[model samples]
Target: MKIALLQMTSGIDPDVNAATLETAIADAAGQGAAMLFTPEMSGLLDSNGARAATQVTDEVHDRVLARVRAAAAREGVWVHLGSLAVEGDEGDPRWANRAFVIDADGEIAARYDKVHLFDVDLPTGESWRESSRYVPGQDTALVNTPVGKLGLSICYDMRFPALFQALSGAGATILSVPAAFTVPTGQAHWHTLLRARAIENACWLVAAAQTGTHEDGRSTYGHSLVVDPWGKVVLDMETTAGLAVCEIDPAAVDDVRSRVPVIAHRRAIPVPA
Candidate 1:
């Protein structure tokens, strides 16, 4: 299947962001893309409370999600609407950071809320406390796509290898990681972490990313990539709002698993301090 990873620079306006998303999806569909993926915070990007203010609504009612659903139906393509800012329970209206799988009929197949909140201080004086603005999900989500079992995870979750191991153990053949990684952290650990996750899990890694700069002047590293089961980057996009397409044969998953067998070679012993 040909999958397209869309790298975009999202702003604070929902209408404008939706238009950009529509155009990008159309372009990818025009190129014969079977499934298209977008980045995190696909609708709006805000620094702090500004994001919290307007995130209070179901994504099914969100205008951007509506347009995305329409695009998927019109183009007869599957859309992985990466992560949208959603309102949660009574704690300052947290962001869900949700991902949706829209089928060809434009029906939502499954949704996954990001489990890990990005709460860290970067070395470049840029600090983010995602838990302060968003709620973390308690369940690990996996969706059966036309391709295979796709594991869903957002930006900060890439740092935790155990999540990928759990997904791989659950028969996930493809892993989707949508991120809005800060430029500093992305420059230091983005590519390496992604490759490491793919190598460790022996699954195809498809990551759509946020690129360039947002309205808040926060720069994101934009190297959207698709790593094969063998940990080779099949397609990569850098510093631009564009699409990276590649054909992923599901057979590669079995080949890699058989060669490595790391998942089954576990001794399950306690770690020595």
Candidate 2:
């Protein structure tokens, strides 16, 4: 299957972001891609809590998501809409960093709320408290798509190996890790971590990323990548805000797994007394 990844520099305005996504979706489909993957916060990327709160809304009311879904249906392609900041359920004041899988028919196939919250004090005098405004998800999400069974995860979730283990164990052949990562950490750990995950699970890993400085005054390490099951870097859109396409061979998963057989060799670790 052919898939397209959109590396973007999203701003504070949801409308502008939506238009960008619509255009990218059409372009991806025109290039004969079966699906398009977008970076994190595709709808809006704002660091200011006060300013972002004014634009954030529930999934049903998010114009960006609606536009993307419509575009998916119109283009006859699937879309992995990386993640969006959305209002949580009634009585829950906190919001959710959510990812959505929209089918070609414009219907939601699955949703995954980001489980790992980025609450850190970076050495660069930058700090984030994701838990302050969002509630972390408790469950993993896997859905069937044109490529294969995809495991859903956001930026911070990539650090947790147990999550990937669970997904791969549950028959996930492809993993989607959409992120907006800080320059400091991205430079240090991004490639190594993603490649390791794909190698460990013997699965295809697709990561769409945010690039360049945004209206929110934050810069991301953007090297949107696609790693095949054999740990080969098939595609890399290095630090550019645009769209790129790559072909994925589902048979690679089975071929790699058969060669390594790590999943079958995995043994449960007992808790120390």
Candidate 3:
């Protein structure tokens, strides 16, 4: 299957972001992409938690999501919209860092919210407290696509290997980690961790990511990559807001699994007492 990954430097405006994304998706479809994936904060990158909390609305009322659904139907391709901040509650008004998969008919096939909150102080003196604005999801989601079973995750979730292992155990051949990683962390850990996950799970890895600078002067690492089952980077969009297209054959998954059989080689046992 031909898949396209979209990397964008999103800002705080929803309307402009949607228009830009539509153009990108159209370009990918024109190139014969059967499926298109966008990066995290595909709609808007609202840096101010307080302001974003007041602006973002419920998923049912989100104009951004509606536009994506319409675009998917119009293009006749599946769209994996990276992540959007949707309303969660009344008082706290949490954000759901969510990813949506829209089928060719524009119907939502699956929705996965980010389970892990990005609450940490970077060595660069940059602090991110995602929990203050977003309510973390409680479940791991794996969606069956025409290509294969795909595991969904966002940003910080990439750091946790156990999640990918679980997704692989649940029959996922492709793992998607849509991220807006900080420059510090991305430069240090991005390629290493992504490749490690692909090699360990013996699954294809696709990570569409935020690039350049946002409205808040925050720079994100933008090397969006697609790794094959054997942990080879088939396509790399390094630090530029563009699309990376590649073909991922499901048969390759079986080929690699049979060769290594790493999943079956494991003997489950308790940790050291």
Candidate 4:
């Protein structure tokens, strides 16, 4: 299957970001891609909590999501809209970093909130407190797409192997990990972690990333990648903010799994006393 990954330097303006996504959807479809994957924070990327709150709204009221859905239907393509920062339920004061899987008919197939919040103080003097503003999701999401059964996750979730293990065990042939990673961490562990996940789980790993400096004065290490089941890097859009397309063979998953047989041999680990 042919898939497109959008590497974006999302800005603070939701409207602008929405337009960018709309165009990318059409472009991807025109290029014969069955699906398009976008980066995290695709709608708005503002570091200023006060300013970003002005644009944040409930999922039903998000203009960017609405536009993207319409575009997806018009183009007749599936879209894995990475992650959008939106308002949470009533009286919750916090927001959600949510990812949506939109079908070709513009209907939402599944929604997955980012389960792992990035709450780390990096060595580069950069700090993040994702839990401070967004609530963590409770469950994992797996959905069928044009490519295959896709497992959903966001930026910080990449660090957790258990999440990928669950997805693979549940018959997921593809994993979608959309991210807006910091430059420091991305440089250190992005490629290594992604390859490891694919190798261990024996699934295709597709990661769409946010690249370049953003309007909010933050920079991301963008290396949107597509790793095959054998942990081969088939496509890599390094540090470029644009759209890139690549072909993925699902049969490779079967080939790798048959050779390794790791998933079948997986045994439950016991807790140490």
User: Model 2, 99-176: lDDT tens per residue?
Assistant: 999999999999999999999999999999999999999989999999999999999999999999999999999999
Error of 4 at 203 (Å): 0.5
Note the Cα lDDT for every prediction shown. Answer: 0.86, 0.96, 0.88, 0.96
TM-score of 3: 0.96
What stretches of model 4 exceed 4 Å from their correct place?
none
Winner of 1 and 3 under lDDT: 3
Residue 82 lDDT, candidate 2, scale 0-100:
98
Residue 242 alpha-carbon offset, candidate 4, angstroms: 0.5
TM-score of each: 0.95, 0.99, 0.96, 0.99
lDDT of 1 by residue, 1-273 (tens): 788888999988888888988887888788888888899888887785765476447765788899999989988889999988877655555667788899988899988889989888877888899888788988888888877899999999999998999999998999999999988888899989999999998899999999997887888998998998899998889888877777889899999989998788756778999
Output the lDDT of residue 219, model 4.
96
Q: After superposition, how far is residue 4 of candidate 3 from its true place, in Å?
A: 0.4
lDDT of 4: 0.96
If the candidates were sorted by their TM-score against the true structure, best first, what order would they fall in? 4, 2, 3, 1
- The sequence of per-residue lDDT tens digits that candidate 4 reaches over residues 1-273 is 799999999999999999999999999999999999999999999999999999999988999999999999999999999999988878899999999999999999999999999999998899999999999999899999999999999988999999999999999999999999999999999999999999999999999999999998999999999999999999999998999999999999999999999899999999999
**TM-score for predicted model 4 compared with the true structure:** 0.99
| Tens-place lDDT digits, model 3, residues 1-273 | 889999999988898889877887788788888888899989889788666655588889888898988888898888889999987756766778999988888899999999999999988899999898789998898998766799999989998988999999889999999999999999899999999999989999999999998886899999999998899999889998877788988888999999998787766779998
- Give residue 194's error in model 1 in angstroms: 0.5
Candidate 3: count of backbone clashes, pairs at least 3 residues apart or interchain:
0
